[model samples]
Target chain A: MASARSDRRISADHIPVKLVIAGPFGVGKTTIVGALSEIEPLNTEEVLTQAGTLVDDLTGVNEKTTTTTAIDFGRLTLPGVVLYLFGAPGQTRFQVLWDELVRGALGVLVLADTRRIDDSFAVLDLVENAGIRYAVAVNHFPDSPQYPPEALRQALDLDPRTPLLVCDARDPASARASLIALVEHIRELVLS
Target chain B: MTSGRQRRRVVPDYMAAARLSVPEHISVERTTLVSIAADADAGGLDPPASHLLALLRDEPLSVYECAAHLGLPYCVVRLLVAGLVGNGTLLTRDPPPSDLPDIEILELVLSGLRAL
Candidate 1:
């Protein structure tokens, strides 16, 4: 039975590419992943061990050694390559986890909610500090105010060369356009 | 969230089995893709390792997917994957280049996205 089962399996090689979607807690990071992903988004938990010194010590000797954080991700298959979209945990406490997530990523897409545009500051800093290329896509809500590209860029204090665009996280075409813009930006940087 | 925090005090039963030591050089992340080695000998592996191999035999998967499917902690699955990699029982595809991908790959990705 085992041999037969093994025979049915086909061995194929594929290169895995990672792209991260980052934003504040309610910035629709997961929604963007769901929109672009071919499969249902999957959730995985990572066990983070906070340093002993960092934890609060109500009992004097801290015993809280570990905490688990959930990361939602989705996959897309393209020819010989597979694209993985990871929704980064939005809390400030997961700085270490952010480092791991972006270690070898192609680029990051920072989603912003116009109503809470300030919430994206911390995430932008994290992405910049990591030295990875990134773009900002303001997720448009019906009630949120709309501004010109240059005005929004100025408000966010983004670098002139950085790609800034607007998208609707719930719309597949809009989400895909944001991703394409990010890739084009990365390509431009590489060529330059 | 409360249950996850509460469960940390007691080691889960799944982790009580013999611990597999991961090598120093092998780094397992949620995005790291793993596949079974071409000439792997599947005999004599522990149940977890065997199960991991069985899963990978069908198609390559990221470490997170493997952990989720096995119902084990991400850390435990990392060690299991690292151990398998150390013994040449599996192969790993590192994540995309840290800086920027090659122009050709980027173009391919752009075309693929456009086509979709």
Candidate 2:
């Protein structure tokens, strides 16, 4: 499957909608891409080393090896649309790559882990600073407290227009709904 | 394959900015343009995305050319293009990439030079 994707990328005819999946470490960016992508996702990842302990937060994700280095690339087809999803790695060290992942994106789906919502503030800030519209999704961890949308909004200080929702990340249907909200939000921004 | 209109871009002005940044006059060349979806992790990408994929399947188009054709605002277009290039969907043989936030660059350069 990976080899097949290699050839397809070279074909000079496949245009992809570039969507960025951003959140803090272990917020399920790679896993979501893997679940939704029609093609075998391409990940540029390296396992975390002991040296990384100084920088990467290892609080909840002691087991995450092979953290994405550059981006996690996936292909998903939505009816007539072919979405090329790029899951941005969570580490602050790789913020250099954020601009690339952002290109051609019409909107953003920012995942926030309720257990570590604090970690997400910076990612949300980056997206907001870029001036492109975005929506927030709370990736519900087993331990993450389920808060009302309004409470989450106040916690995140989200703009009234920003769509705030929750998802399991493991569920395909729920994930799809979140993306649909993003598209709608983009349309609203454009029209306004 | 020729491109087709799926829907109108809200702001062609964004594409215009991206097109102006490029130093080329090609009527058409393949370029990697970005499409942002809201809940990609949850799966809500736009419908026109297929057209976008078909547009970038092969070669890297100049920022200049994409804007003129797509008619999006240049600033918005540039933002998207920069992000896509960052993601490795496109490449430029010249100038490498300059999307490093200007502040970060200044700090890196200043720090390096001072250390030297």
For DockQ, the strongest prediction is 1
DockQ of the two-chain complex in candidate 2: 0.04
TM-score of each: 0.83, 0.57
Candidate lDDT values, in order: 0.77, 0.56
Q: Candidate 1 on B53-77: residue-level lDDT in tens?
A: 8878768888877776666777788
What's model 1's overall lDDT?
A: 0.77
Q: B72-101, model 2: which lDDT tens digit per residue?
A: 433344554554444444443221122322
**Residue A59 in candidate 2 has what lDDT?**
79
Q: What lDDT is reached at residue A72 by model 1?
A: 69
Q: Across all candidates, what is each one's fraction of true contacts kept?
A: 0.61, 0.04
> For candidate 2 chain B, which ten residues in a row score worst on lDDT?
B93-102
